[model samples]
Target: MLKHLKEKKDVGFFTSIAGLMNSCSVLDLDAFERTQKAEGLGVGSEGTAGEKNMHDADFTCALFRFLQLLCEGHNLEFQNYLRTQAGNTTTVNVVISTVDYLLRLQESIMDFYWHYSSKEVIDQPGKDNFCRAITVAKQVFNTLTEFIQGPCSLNQQALAHSRLWDAVGGFLFLFAHMQDKLSKNSSQLDLLKELLQLQQEMVIMMLSMLEGNVMNGTIGKQMVDTLVESASNVELILRFFDMFLKLKELTSSSSFQEIDSKNSGWITPKDFQKAMEQQKIYNPDEITFLMSCCEPNMDDLIDYREFTERFHNPAKDIGFNLAVLLTNLSEHMPNDPRLQRFLETASSVLNYFEQFLGRIEIMGEQKEIFADFHSK
Candidate 1:
């Protein structure tokens, strides 16, 4: 929309937006502050990146173009303006700073992605903004990739370019989260299609970037360690979600209540075994699996009530602990090739769990049909 800016004021306006878009976008300041105090570190550890501000799409779009054109056509003027008027002394160079800002914007997009996707119900505006963020992320990454391989001296700006690790790590976690969401069958067809497409784009782009030489000599121990820890958290949290779904279905049956005949809210191991034998809903091996889900007391009683209560609200559990971990560890992790392989393993296992659940559901339906036919 803002094609040409002849006035110095116009240049300043776009610059100000760029800075605003680069500042930290804390969705919950109190929660963030709590985490910072708990961890003894600032939110910068999680890559304090601003979410792409799309309140006025037209204005943001025009600002993006203006900044790009400034870097391309008016490179000298932009650098000169920064030299004299830019308050931020950290602007190393036009290309490096722009790339850094754009990369942080992508980071902001990830922040928004996690926030909305983790919600129980996303409003229409949230969905629209998420889609917009996805589009902006693709553009930003592509531009940054081009800029990295462009005429700029990547070696000189290696520290700034190292932020790509954060960007890549964010997408890896996103890839896992999107896959988990798809398994739940929550989204409508259109949104589902979009998520699937986004996954594909993420895979292709990330794989290409990781395999490329652009990151050569830039990997650091701190970054890789951070990513590894983040991946471990992702694997654990995803497993919790899977466990909650399966346990919820199991506890919904009358078997648990039947076993706790006295309404004591707890059942002994022997009583549980007896109930399973009478119900015949599960085989010996399956019963063993169910027993593993139980929490045992010192008296060897299975705390059915307590166990169910622990995961009664999977979303709430996730929101409190896993969500914070994902948000804090969200920034830079998983750039190492070995970690990528580990993610692939984690993904395959998650898919296998989904398939296993689907089979169980189908078998339950068949059992119900057989019972109805027998009664008829």
Candidate 2:
């Protein structure tokens, strides 16, 4: 029937299939299990001779195949139909809900396989069942990927017009979660390879959308805005770096030469903690977490080179530093009204500038504006 519909190329027939596909939503496994139990159809329940037996695995396989058929042909027509359906909130909800459900199902299967395969003695039947489960889960993932990527594959039209980024983000998050889960089990190397390939493809697609052709300034403007935002908080971050430099000087001085002799420019956690306390900067908890993240091996020493590297390449430790700063700022708010007001005003002004930049970036022929702005 699907092939016939495909061959006929009837709009209504394909639209109906796309609508059905969009209607697919994530299943509530817990509720489903509860209902199954109420109906005397538990996970491993079997019917007597001459009676019909229903299994969750069977139902899952059937659903998987159905979805696979919906996405089998790189069906651009169906994808276009879905793009139209996306205008309806209910349809979008259904699509997202379904994707979420499939991701959860895939995660559950991977978790089960990882757990069972790690055991010393694995049941043959159980392992086979899990292998089949993994296959079904992969099918579910591929079906969704094909559906989302099919339209976006046509240059960047679908990417610009549809909520492709949202879909990409959702799938990326799920894939990351799956990757983490599989990382623990050494047996899932093949799955990990496939996941890495998918991640690379998704990232390339996202870059294509952002960068586009040579004439496109979207990515350049985005980079500029990011730089501006990062610079906005530079003063606070610089103060932290300055404190680090001061501490480095203190620890490297003759007074602490004995301690420095052991690690040759690396300072012990105790010394680092004391320095932070002297600076009255980070709290005890923040200091502890920072020490752990920086050291990571309980080596009892923080490398001076490594510490400075984080400043040069701020991406490495910026999140931790920002989080610590925010926590400290919040703690001091009650006692430091003036500091709070100053921060609030600065944040407001920076936000206004960000909005202004966004508007300027969106304007056509921004070259003249940029040239004029830069000349001033």
TM-score of each: 0.40, 0.32
Candidate 2 residue-wise lDDT, 1-376, digit = tens:
5345445544564345445544443233344334446445445544321122113545555664665566557665554444344333333322343455555554554444454445543343333433444454455555555555433333244433444434443444444354444433335535544554454444333333332222324333332233233443333333333333344454445655655666566776677666656655456754554454354226866775556443333222332333233222333233444435434534422332232222112222323221101000
Candidate 1 — which residues are off by over 4 angstroms? 1-53, 58-121, 150-162, 192-216, 219-229, 232-376
C-alpha lDDT (0 to 100) for residue 277 of candidate 1: 65
Error in Å for residue 153 of model 2 = 8.6
Best by TM-score: 1
Q: List candidate 2 segments past 4 Å from native.
A: 1-9, 23-27, 31-155, 187-194, 197-201, 204-376
Worst 10 residues of 2 by lDDT: 367-376
Number of the top lDDT candidate:
1
Computed on alpha carbons, the lDDT of every model, listed in order, comes to 0.45, 0.42
Report how far off residue 54 is in candidate 1 (Å). Answer: 1.6
Q: Model 1: per-residue lDDT, tens digit, 185-271?
A: 334324544544553443333322322123222333334454575665456445545444445555557766765668887778787
